[model samples]
Target: MRCLVRERNKTRIGVTALATLAVVASGTAVVTAPEAAASFPRGEWNETAYRGQVEVIPAKDDRSDRRVLRGKVFVDRDRDSVSDPGERGLRGVMVSNGRDVVTTDARGYYELPAYDNMTVFVTQPAGYQVPVDEYNIAQFYYHHLPQGSPELRYGGIAPTGPLPEAVNFPLVESRATHTKDQNCVIAGDLQTYDKTEVEYARKGAINDLAQRHDYTGCGVLFVGDIVGDDLSLYPDVKDLTKSLNGPVRFLPGNHDLDYDARTPEHSFDTFRAQLAPAYYSYDVGRVHVVALNTVRYPCTPDVDNPDGKRPGCDDPENKPTYNGRLDERQLEWLRKDLAKVPRNKLVVIASHIGLVNYADEGSPVHQVDQVREVYDLLKGRKAVAVSGHSHSIENMKTGDLAKGWSDLFGLKGLPFPHITAGAISGDWYSGQMTEDGYPIAVGRDGGRPGVVTLEIEGNRFRERYTVTGQSDRFQTQLGLNTPTYRDWYEARQEWNANPEGPAPELGDPHVVSRDDLAGTTWLTTNFWMGSTGSRVKVSIDGGPARWATRTQQMRGEDQNVGPEWSDPHAVAQQLVHGGSVADRSMHLWRFALPEDLAVGTHRAEVTAIDSYGRRFTDALTFEVVEQR
Candidate 1:
């Protein structure tokens, strides 16, 4: 991935309208508009109605000379990318060269020092909009890799020898961006390793995206792992984006790296060329999104240290190593980027490796190395982070804590929301294939393959998860966790991998005896997106509802793992079919059974209320039989 650079100057310069027609170079395209008087007269500034022309001049003789990339942030009145005669420029619009951010002048012109591997993009300012391609993918940036990338397995950017004189960005008036309320889809890993998995993604989440139109302005942000390790599947990824109903943005995951590249500089050359910048920021409504590149590959040991111990790849030239980290350059850019954003606006930070996770709870390698630094940067702001490397769904609220985080980083509690959006390619496309031709890749935490949506109202936000091939009402999975179920869980693990007989069954989900209740019997509910503010209540046999306690309290306690904490509903499917073991989670809740209950059939009504106060109800039946 490309590094974020510093801006040379914030002062904007005015370019005189060309009296003569400039010849465009071969393989170059020029877009121009009739010169109009500057909307904002000298000494007076209007945020809107600023006007300018977009001119493309031929390259000069010096191939090595780095030129300044000058462009106009014009208002595309007709919604066409080309700046027409009636269209005007937008002043104070932020533009960046993958690093430094500069505002458009009164005339709407912006210039930044250009480099070989920079991507110059205009941040979608509030009340303004950028053009979307045929696939509803935002087309706001211009990649400036004049000579393209070095030779690789999957082709990187093709050669574009000289820089164009004008790299204009067009925007139209948009009320959707100014509205207080908005819906933004945040999807996690679409780790499709091959063509079949690509189809799974298409039928699964991509199909879901096509059916939804609510998220128009903020759109969908796939938080990394767009494809599996195979970079050649990028075309298929592009094809999948076409199914989306709104603008689609992406971040890069460890699997998306170009493994063949020797240096970290070119690790994501193909990704940058085909998808988006390694790191960037944008705005919609009162929310500012800061997409970060947190994966550092070929992580070598510090040879200078006295400790002889080393981790990851010792010789990266032969085999690759990956870790969750942000280079110093990205951190600097983040500081500068946040400086421009208002403190009151809600900041949604997106990254591939999460700041913290339950999946890789104790492993420091799977979590971001600079968690404290990032938190310190956004100290007082209303911020939330969304990430997707671990393939599990998690919604950690403010003040929540995990034992791993405390033990590794000395962090006592979370200061803001940190959600790990569940993977789209659930459990790496494992398990039995569904009727829809996709695998029922239930995650390790019992979270079904799905996407997370953030419903934002000004500076406050509420998050919800939508499981693939299911309705919004499908929020929780209910199961009976008893001694019998625990025995079945163990037996299935021992025999299911290589079965000598019929697979071990989980018996009847609704039948339990006094002996079963005498042991460890309880009602378990896996609230897929449950967080601190959420609650789960159970009402047995039309009695008063009693709140079910969350198994893992994010109060600095160690994670409660193993079969006792596993979601029996997930275990049933995973053990019988095939997939990752659902051994632990941060969202599972349980209520103990009443030992004094009379012998009879019992009906339990479960109600789960999310952090947003939205309620979902499900029912389960079990028999409390008399001892033989």
Candidate 2:
């Protein structure tokens, strides 16, 4: 929602922060933009330390004699991180120790069976908001690791000398979160691998979030892969979140795991220390969001990896691998957590790896192994599933079927809608650089980098995608997949494989010759979050609107891959510039153009109506030439 204007000096200047409701006479919230990438300070930066950390009162002893963990979910009227006298305790707030889910008593006091290395947290109830650090990271959990992490590469959790007298979670009342209409943002894979990538993220998605004010209550959930493999960058990554105005919550992805850890239990110790619990749940308005740790790194061979590709985990001689499956404890926690949520409330199940997706539809190592079980638990309830990991944007509705999902899981169709909320580091932040300061990073499935927002009303919700550096209405990408372009795509692929000559050029993508029309040309529309009921209508030169057929219908068929199903708009960037090929997608739709058109410039307008009946418009101008 940040409007950026290019200055005469060719430097990008952000026009507004949009966080403050205050607007100018023109209704613009003009504020200074983020400093340029080079402007970032080197070395350690804990600028957010002034905001303070999670509240705790540790015991004087190195260890505790207590067998139970106690905490209070109290209202912090003074806005301090600690609970003060006369600040009333909030009643019935959900609290958990990673496994058991329990609610506070009438006094806001709750206890859970305490164990070593447990994270005790309280879920912020509707009308209440958990305090966020200066970096905007929510501080609601206390990691009770007596001896700390086992000397991890990132220095995992520090030694918690002893259990605290109380791990009180403070909350402030919020009018934004108390309402039935909530816009919750779900972002996939900020996955910045280094400081450079961190700058890219800050300029791209982080900047987009900094300027957004609609999600102050429900907040933003970074589904997984908060960072790539380098855990040391966690501090810098946290700094990027400083721009956010909402509570930032994260679930661990395979990339976030401690690869050196020999045991799966310790795989995410560092993540827990720096970010969040491996799995957690919270409430916003009438929606109950359950974030699950679906990635099991160092996966043992004994566990069934049905139709998966993870080669090893049992051998100590080699590096441990990861599989998409929930730990038994986490699975049980999900069951217990859902039981307490009201049946009338909408349930949003978020995870690192998707329960099911078009990108990894056939690989159990990428999709959750216990998807069926998870579905059964949410059965008869108004629930939807969301995830990251695949880096593709998929909006699969209930009953939608994919051949891989069917073969891998022995499942015929989806029971609930499952969305793969694209990625911030699209294609690992590959492709050509843009003036906006990041790479094109078009996803393998052809969707651009973006974030998904679920607008919930009562027990129902609608999903909308906002592309990075773009507005909410920027939903569709249009390109011509003409015969000439497809051939150039193949030629470029071959050239990239063996560099003897210059790469093939996708010349004048919008302009196609008569030969191209004679051979065949289809107008491709990459509708980022398009689903079963979505429609794409194209009108040429203000003529009647005509429907475009979706390339892959997601109806029990295999992926319609290769150049034919590719988005030329995305492929042109991927092939010549760099990054993953946009060779396949479930959201791409194609409409054939008339071959008998006169040789001249023509204009076409596209109207894409999503399943929720929200309409978006885009247009393309092209010349019908006699020859190239």
Candidate 3:
């Protein structure tokens, strides 16, 4: 992986210094008169060259200085921080710090009295998507100064003082939907980097969802990587998600960061401003959905290289300090959130990164490091975690957190399944193009570039994948395996490297074996099992038959730039490499015939059992050609 390099034209986009004060007598309230507000500060308010000794002090017993609040507003019209003339003084916009609201003056700006600990946010109007950063992370809201406010149990602004002056809010054309439904859809990554990629996402997946109306019970949940970079594409994304026949919710991925963020506190400010929540829980039917920001951005400064060669890279200083860990603050809030949820509610913890190993071989940054802790928190309670970022499908079910060491983290196997919702883009923009003129980016797993539906009926939910306009059978694919096919597989690699593009041709598996098991187990399978008794076990003549290992880990490390983040899947494949194709010791199994009795021909069959114990079998018969 390449290190993130800073471009030469790096300039600050928007920076507004705001002073907010909220002063009120105990059990008393403050109100502004509608008509008498004529004398209040109006138009773009600027405290030119104001510095130091600023505090939100309580007003003394003198019944004076109550006319208006003094403050300043900075406009970032062009969105690059250096406040220019044309970009300044945006008028007629309304600004509110949670409680009170005020409209801007004719000069495209306004000023309001300061209030203590108010969360200043604009009511994003229709037709526009908020400006985000290169990572598609939103850019809105002013950071609360003086650090921590009186913390609320569930998190909101504290009633500290009066509101700030010139508390300006930025607005854009939004294609937002205000829908209230019970049928829900869960979508994974829509990580489009540019216009072409955005079109790929729109045509490949969004176009497919556009025709879909069968959302199970609620709207849709897009679980992160909304854009690879180029936050400008967000408006289009908002339009795409709006195409869905439901409400859309979002989470953040590692790629969705403001690389320009000056502090750790401001890291997800843009994301929170646009997406609404970082680690919040909402309810629908008998189910509760908790969206989390597992990518705990590092706040500490870069100390490893004083020369600053690795300025913006996620180096030792910038690496996500806590993997899969909910910071003490978020954890505390989560506990409170869960308290409001009943024990029997079907809870779905939706995150951008999977709780455990993503697709067996894991990507360090995309899989939560502290999966066990998250698992243990939900132990005994019926729960499932749906994640994206690996761009592959891996449905893991290990049975309970008590197993000690988790298959992905340090906990034991889980009591529920942890799913990596396959990506909408798929393979990071690679592979063959389809008839639709888009790459067949959907993973080899049964997953396709569409959406997942969860039919919630009380506490129990049923899940299914809608592969564009195709039927269930079309959504899944099975591989054929045969001896003659094995011969062709061996010749496929070397033939490509020759100067002459003319390479060896692979024979038809159907013609080679006449055995039904020809394409059965050459690679892997996405069983897409429901939450029940699904089991996949294979044995050759009563001997152990292991599943094939994926050739690539699905994600790579930027080790060329920083310290390696360990992944369990990569470590597993490395430990078990290089053995005979027939060796049972190999993690990936390949069978060789038993020499003594097999001279003429032989037969082998593999079986698969679903949750209800329903079985499907495939068999193959091949000649044991005698060695001359």
Q: For this target, which candidate reaches the highest TM-score against the unseen true structure?
A: 2
- Candidate closest to the true structure, highest lDDT: 2
- Per-residue lDDT tens digits for candidate 2, residues 541-588, read 999999999999988999888888999999998887878998999999
Model 1 clash pairs are 50-89
Model 3: ten consecutive residues of lowest lDDT: 578-587
| 1-628: candidate 3 lDDT, tens digit per residue | 0001111232332223111212221111211122112233332211110111111223333333354443323344343223334655444444444334554566655444443322344322222223332222233344232233333222222222332222333333222311222356778888888889888877777887666655422446788888885555666776665445433567777666654554444455445434544555445556677777776665333421233322333453445342333455555545555554569977888888776543433233345555656666786788878888766655555452221133234443456767667678765655556788666553433244656666666666655555644554332233333444444434543454343665555433323232323233232223433222443344445556544232222123111110011111111111223111110100112233333434455445545454445554545444443331
For every candidate, C-alpha RMSD to the true structure in Å? 7.2, 9.9, 15.5
- Candidate 3 lDDT: 0.46
- How do the candidates rank by lDDT, highest first? 2, 1, 3
TM-score per candidate, in order?
A: 0.88, 0.89, 0.56
Q: After superposition, which runs of candidate 3 have C-alpha atoms over 4 Å from their true positions?
A: 1-182, 299-324, 360-364, 398-408, 442-447, 482-532, 535-609, 612-628
What lDDT tens digits, residue by residue, belong to model 1 across residues 422-526? 999989999888899899898999989999999999989989899999999999999899888898899889896678988778777668878888996889999
